[model samples]
Target chain A: ELKVEQNPLFLSMQEGKNYTIYCNYSTTSDRLYWYRQDPGKSLESLFVLLSNGAVKQEGRLMASLDTKARLSTLHITAAVHDLSATYFCAVAYTGTASKLTFGTGTRLQVTL
Target chain B: DTAVSQTPKYLVTQMGNDKSIKCEQNLGHDTMYWYKQDSKKFLKIMFSYNNKELIINETVPNRFSPKSPDKAHLNLHINSLELGDSAVYFCASSPNQGTEAFFGQGTRLTVV
Candidate 1:
């Protein structure tokens, strides 16, 4: 069974602060994804890290993958109030499969 | 337009009743999946279909059946619904296996 774990399941940071959420998986995966979800809305894709050392950034968020270490990270730069949401790291099944094993999620609460 | 959409955003029903949630993606993806989010907010894969062929079937109960009529459509039908079945169900699709997936807004299933 592949297990995906996220550290600091709950995080509260003030606006303009920086923090990183870690995602560690138990097995090798072909790809990893970062997603964000509001309290009552659907998940929105943030980044897709497809290879080792792959890093992607969008606005105040950056995601990187270290496949060799079976880990991924989502870093927030200068967090803002709108960044308050649940962030999830999902690992894709190996080979040509679309199934995903998701982490426990990190609920971020950015305040002033 | 919604890339992936699931009908009946909210469903409330009595136990033992049968219900189905519909999902359709207009993104022309070849693979679709069904995921369940429990109260604790842990997301788990339930079923996956690639080009209308059953590809991944998680250890979900037999009462939950997933049907895919086409590459762009997948539906989950639950019979003899139990209280444990209450959760937020999401439908997702990807252009191919091991790729970024677009998710639906999710259907909140509530069993009374």
Candidate 2:
């Protein structure tokens, strides 16, 4: 069974502050994804890290994957109030079925 | 255009009622999935469909059933809804099994 764990389930930050959310999986997987969800809204794709040492960035958000360590990280640089949302990291095992196991989301609250 | 879409953003129904949520993806992807998010913010995979074939079926209750009429749509039907079934349901699609998925806005199901 594959299990995903995320750190700092709840985060409160001041505007313009930086933070990083960590995601660790119990098994070996090569694909990782980061998604953001606002209250009462569906998830928005943030990043997709497909290989070892793969990193992707968009605006103030960056995501990296380390396949050897079975870990992924989503770094938010200079977060704004608009960035306040619940973030989740998911792991997909490399196979034909390709089902994703999701982590317990980290709820971020950014105050102005 | 919306890449992925789900019907009935909010659903309120009584226990033992039967309900269905419709999902469609215009991204021309070959894989679609159903996920449930509980109150604790834990997102779990309920079903995965690839090319209209069932792929991954997680440890979900028998009341929950998924139907993929075509490659672009996957619908979820729940029977004898219980209070525990009140949660957000998401529909997603990916190009293949190991790729990043595009998600719908989600349906918030409230079992009264």
Candidate 3:
């Protein structure tokens, strides 16, 4: 079974600070994804890291993948109140179908 | 227009009752998935269907069944709902295996 673990399950950071949420998986997988979910809302895709060393950044969030280590990371640069949400990292395994195993989410609360 | 959508954004039912959650994707994707997010915010994949074919079924109980009537629709039916089943259910789709997935607004099911 593929297991994904994330660190700092709940984070409370002040605005303008920087933090990183780590996602580590148990098995080998090349595709990794980062998603953000606001309170009472659906998840929104943040990044799709398809290869080792692949990194994607949008707005104030950046995500990177390291397939060999079975790890992925979502880094928040200069956090803002709007960035407060629960972030999840998912690992994909391709067999007869593509299955995504999501990590324990990191709930971030950015305050002034 | 919403790329992926799920009906009944919130459902409240008594234990042992049966309920169904419907999902549809207009992105012309070939793969659809059902995921459950527990109150603790852990997300796990429950089922995966590719081109209307069942591909991935996790260790979910037999009481839960997924039906894919077509390539664009995948619905989940849960029989004898229990309190443990109370959580947010999300539907998602991807163009194909190992690709970026788009998620729908989750259906929050509360088994009272």
Candidate 4:
């Protein structure tokens, strides 16, 4: 059984603040993904981390993976109101076709 | 154009009724998946198809059956629906296993 855990299941941050969401998995995986979802909407892909020390940044969000530690992080730099949503991290083990085990999402609410 | 799309963005039905949700991807991806997001926002994998073959089948109820007529389409049919089946069902696709997945807008199912 692959277990995925996320910290701070709910977060409320002020605009322009910085925060990091952590994702930890119980087993080694070939890839990890970060996704964002708004209320009543499906998930949108944020980043794909394929290797250790891989980091990707888009706009105010940056995601990094540390495969050795079986951990991944999604960092928000200078959060804005539009960044309010639910974030999820999923892991795909080797030899699987999108059989991802997702973490309990972290709901983020950024206010002015 | 939508890369991935699901029909019936919202569905409200009575228990014991049978219903089906349709999904199609235009990205030319070889793999497709169905995920369930529960009330607590826990996303879990239900089924996956690769090149029209059932690749991964999670421990979902037998009433929930997935059909893939072609490489680009996957449909989910649920019989004898229960209250617990009320959740957002998402359809996603990727070029291959362990790749970044593109998701559809999701179908919100409500059983009363």
> Pick by TM-score: which candidate is best?
1
The local distance difference test score of each candidate is 0.93, 0.91, 0.91, 0.92
Model 3 chain A: worst 10 consecutive residues (lDDT sum): A92-101
Under CAPRI classification, how is model 4 graded?
medium
lDDT for each residue of candidate 4 in A7-105, tens digit (9 for 90 to 100): 889999999999999999998885999999999888888998888999999999999999999999999999999999999999987753447789998
Off by over 4 Å in 1: A96-98
Give the candidates in order of lDDT, highest first. Answer: 1, 4, 2, 3
TM of each candidate vs. truth: 0.97, 0.95, 0.96, 0.96
lDDT of 3 by residue, B20-98 (tens): 9999999999999999988888888899899999888888999999999999999999999999999999999999875
Which has the higher DockQ value, candidate number 1 or candidate number 3?
A: 1
Clashes of 2: 0
lDDT minimum window of 10 residues, candidate 4 chain A: A92-101
User: Candidate 2, fnat value?
Assistant: 0.81
Cα error, candidate 4, residue A51 (Å): 0.9
| Model 1 alpha-carbon miss at residue B65, Å | 0.9
lDDT of 1 by residue, B2-49 (tens): 899999999999999999999999999999999999998999989989
How well does candidate 3 score on lDDT at residue B38? 87
